[model samples]
Target: MYRCDCKSNVLSVLLYVSECWKFTANIEKRLEVFQTKCLRRIMRIFWPNMISNEELRRRAGVSTISEIIATRRWQWLGHVCRMPIDSIPRVALRWTPQGKRNRGRPKETWRRTVDRDLKTRGLTLQTAPTIAADRAKWRSLAVASSTRRRRED
Candidate 1:
């Protein structure tokens, strides 16, 4: 019951609008810390009785924050891809801003993050839409891309 409440209420609130997030390394670290803290609290774990994050997550049946965000982003991507070419979301997905900015390094954008995630699944922006056109295929791909097969260390 506690786990369910944590997932349904806490995680959902924490991850709101996460599908559009840039998901940088710092952000990922912060999210991991926050999740572990929450889990430790809910599980009534205190100092001198530490549990590894993997063990805690396994016990609680909670997926990693990155995995959850990836799943949500891909699901949303599929929805956008399935829209008509002229649809607002489709247009927005393909839109590029004009004018150069002063920059040392380019900040990560949501699109670039999605592209990176797509490459991990051996998919590309060009092919994703066609695959997403088939709902079953897209659903399977989204879930598969986010879920890592558990391995004992």
Candidate 2:
């Protein structure tokens, strides 16, 4: 709810430290160092009843899941899928197939991938006579240039 940049250094650190108190599910490793208790005092300001540290730690642990849990943030995600409001996508996101390609950049287009493999491996492209003719034409032009140069000498 609060922007850290707008605040002083002390307030910024407190805000940053407060967020760290909540565990993230996306994190792969147990970053024990990043998990600190500086936010323990600050949380009491909002929840005066004071949720116990054990309960708090348990809640944080649950948030870091491989799949989305029954959280408030994702409540509208299901609706967003069912009723795609507009044909035009507001944002473009990179799509990557799992297992087939892991890490690094993923191929943007299926046509691009098929074309690349065909050209390099001489598979599908060998049957395409147009491509074959283009290569033959280029080779003939190169040979004709050399022959003309020899005649001038």
Candidate 3:
């Protein structure tokens, strides 16, 4: 009961519009910490009685926040991929800048993250739209991706 409410209400609000978020390591860490804290509180597990995050999540029947975020991102990507070429989001997704950036490591972007996810599934940005055009295939991929545990780097 409590778990369902926390997931449906709190998690939904917490992740609202997250499909467009540029997920960096720091952001991922913060979200994971916040979710762990919330889950611990809801489960009434206080200090001195420690539990591994994996164990806690297993008990709570929840996927990691990263998994949830990744699932949402891919789902959104599929939608964007299926959009008409003239649509703003579709155009934006395929847009490339004409200028060079300041000299350092390139910043991680939402598009880059999506590309990475696609690569993990042996797909590329070029191929993704083709696959996403088929709703059944994209839906299966989305479900499969969500069920697979994320590996920590």
Cα RMSD for candidates in order: 2.0, 25.6, 2.1
* Model 3 lDDT tens row, 94-142: 8888888778956898888888889878899899999999989998887
Give all candidates' CA lDDT scores.
0.86, 0.33, 0.87
Per-residue C-alpha lDDT of model 2 across residues 1-153, encoded as one tens digit per residue: 112322343233433422212224333133321222323332332356566544543544422211121121122222222333352321111233467655775444433533343344343422433433455543443345445544653
Model 1 ranges off by over 4 Å: 104-106, 149-153
lDDT accuracy of residue 84 in candidate 1: 93
How do the residues 56-123 of candidate 1 rate in per-residue lDDT, one tens digit apiece?
Answer: 88888898888888889988999999999999988888888888756886678898998898897788
Candidate No. with top lDDT: 3
Number of the top-ranking candidate, with TM-score as the measure: 1
lDDT of 1 at 49: 94
How many times do residue backbones clash in model 1? 0
